[model samples]
Target: MTALLNELHAHYNGAKLDPSSITRHLEDNLLSPESVLKIVVASDSGGEVVGLLAFTFLNSLVDPAPEKRLQCMIKELFVKESFRSAGTGRDLMNWVIAHAKTAGCARMDWHVKATNEAGIRFYRSFGAAPVADRASFRLMLR
Candidate 1:
């Protein structure tokens, strides 16, 4: 877990992640371990942290769903710069999807930056379709 956090911190150039926040979160939540999926390293070498994926789980509202009856949010993803095109991200997404399937999830969702053309393309390659009718906004607490 610590290894995964460090990898994402390096990839985002100190954005998207705050190490102290993760530390505090682990202290609070790792005890019971809820539905949230935090950053996790994908490593080849025993101690090497290459990339990570962060996600969350949600119960599906729809009735008569065939799968886990839950949904997943792909919150954050990152591959080491040298490993970007090496299929690490794809593998990570695959793992997430498999996990959702095991958890009886019916759907998965996540957002990407509109300006991230490469990211969009990559996500599309993984069968992520764009929702043209919806809009999203966020409010900063501070």
Candidate 2:
């Protein structure tokens, strides 16, 4: 998991990552029954984790119904570079889709970096279409 996180960090930020904080966060939330976060991993024949998908349930703010509508947000989806093009990513995504269905999620959402052409193509193969005219913004809290 740490290796995968490091790969993700390198791909996105190109900076050193503090594994301690990530490990602490995972430890606190991963096994907690009350926690909304969940992680699904794909392992090789040697039982080595090669891919992972992390997701969480969130209340949809766009729904106007009285009952709260839950949606799944994919926080991270990654497969080791060596494992790419071998159906590992597809398996991980299918697992997440099944899990989301079981969790009663009305929808699932995730963000892909604009520079990641292969990632976009992978998602499109899954019948996912990008939201038109929608932009993502983030405010870093120090």
Candidate 3:
């Protein structure tokens, strides 16, 4: 998992080791299932993991403010560029969709940069929307 995280971080940031970084944020977030979903990957060629996808589940009340919570949000997700356009992403999405359905998520949400045309097109091919309107602020929970 650590190695896989490193790889994903490297691709996302274009750097080897980034501090105060999303990689740290993700690793710390993974301490509890309440925070994020760490997807499992299978690989050959000596069983090296080459990708990762991290998502956060947020709960909300719809009517009467129920004791339970409504579902949503895939905070972070990625597949290594080398393995892209392969079945790996499909397999990963299959798992995520199933999990989201089981979790009763009203909708699954994620975002890709506007500059990422290939990613946007690939997502569109899956019948998923590529754009989002958001205000992202990092919380200082420490």
TM-score of each: 0.75, 0.82, 0.69
Candidate 2: the clashing residue pairs are none
lDDT of 1: 0.76
Whole-model Cα lDDT per candidate?
0.76, 0.84, 0.65
Query: Which window of 10 residues has the lowest lDDT sum in candidate 1?
Result: 30-39
How many steric clashes between backbone atoms does each model show?
2, 0, 0
Off by over 4 Å in 3: 18-29, 32-37, 61-69, 130-142
Better of 2 and 3 by lDDT: 2
Off by over 4 Å in 1: 1-35, 62-68
**Candidate 3: deviation at residue 113, Å?**
0.5
**Tens digit per residue, CA lDDT, model 3, 33-115:** 56556555645467766555566567765533433464556655566667777777777777877887787666677767778
Model 1 C-alpha lDDT per residue in residues 1-142, reported as the tens digit of each score: 5556655666567655677787776677743366456555588666566777878877766655656567888888887777788999989988988887888778888988888999999999978899889777999999
| Candidate 2 local lDDT, residue 8 | 69
lDDT of 2 at 75: 87
CA error at residue 45 for candidate 1, angstroms:
1.6
